[model samples]
Target chain A: MAWTAPMIDEVTCGMEVNMYFPAED
Target chain B: MTGAAPAAEAPPIDGSARPFLPRGVRLKFCEVRKSWFLLAPERALKLDQTGVAVLQAVDGERDFDAITAHLAAAFNAPHDRIAADAGRFLAALIARRMVETA
Candidate 1:
């Protein structure tokens, strides 16, 4: 897809934050 | 370190229009990391030296031809070679919304 302002927003939105959780014993 | 994105966009560029970095976009050097990055409000990118130079050349006034010339002279390369390389790089930047035509 051609890059545009909306695409920037899409890409940014797709940037997910990850939180690590320790495994239960 | 991760390098800049590949030069993939091959658009027909108009040489007369100025190619500039949008005001909201930021190109910065990280002293601690010893690397360069292109940062927007929500995203940050790792950039190589050449990527830094490309962003630095866009001054909101120079056209594609002028920018190509500058890079050519800086690297002591031929105009045709620089033109093609710069064109591809700038095209990718344009696609990424990092550079704008003015």
Candidate 2:
């Protein structure tokens, strides 16, 4: 099989995460 | 207090260095994209099919030369060409902390 050189590209995306926490008194 | 971030150590790409993926870095196939990716913490790298093949050959036991030979044989390509390309690719990954050399 003929082969081509490998290439890598960075994938950049914005990510968001939601967290729930107990209230501190 | 905050300090300067540590520099990334340069990896050996002199054909004698053995390369491997570090902890928390993984090569995976994306069903949605139908492509391969190098997934690391907080980051992802899209890879072409050739990239997948090259990465699959990295076992940490194979030095750069061995890896090149394996790839060249499998692809029926020239060893020098594969060596040049694979060496550069691995070096890039090393700089990004996705791959390490032992």
Reference-based TM-score of each model: 0.73, 0.80
lDDT of 1 at A1: 18
Q: B-chain TM-score, every candidate?
A: 0.87, 0.87
> lDDT by residue for model 1 over A1-25, one digit each (tens)?
1121111112233243011111212
TM-score of 1: 0.73
DockQ of each: 0.05, 0.29
Candidate 1, residues B1-102, lDDT tens digits: the string is 133246775685787879887866777665756767666556565565656676688888889888878877776777777677677777877887877898
What candidate 1 gets wrong by more than 4 Å, as runs, is: A1-25, B1-5
Candidates' chain A TM-scores? 0.17, 0.30
What value does the lDDT take at residue B92 in candidate 2?
Answer: 78
Off by over 4 Å in 2: A16-25, B1-12
Task: Give the distance in Å from residue B32's predicted Cα in candidate 2 to where it truly belongs.
Answer: 1.3
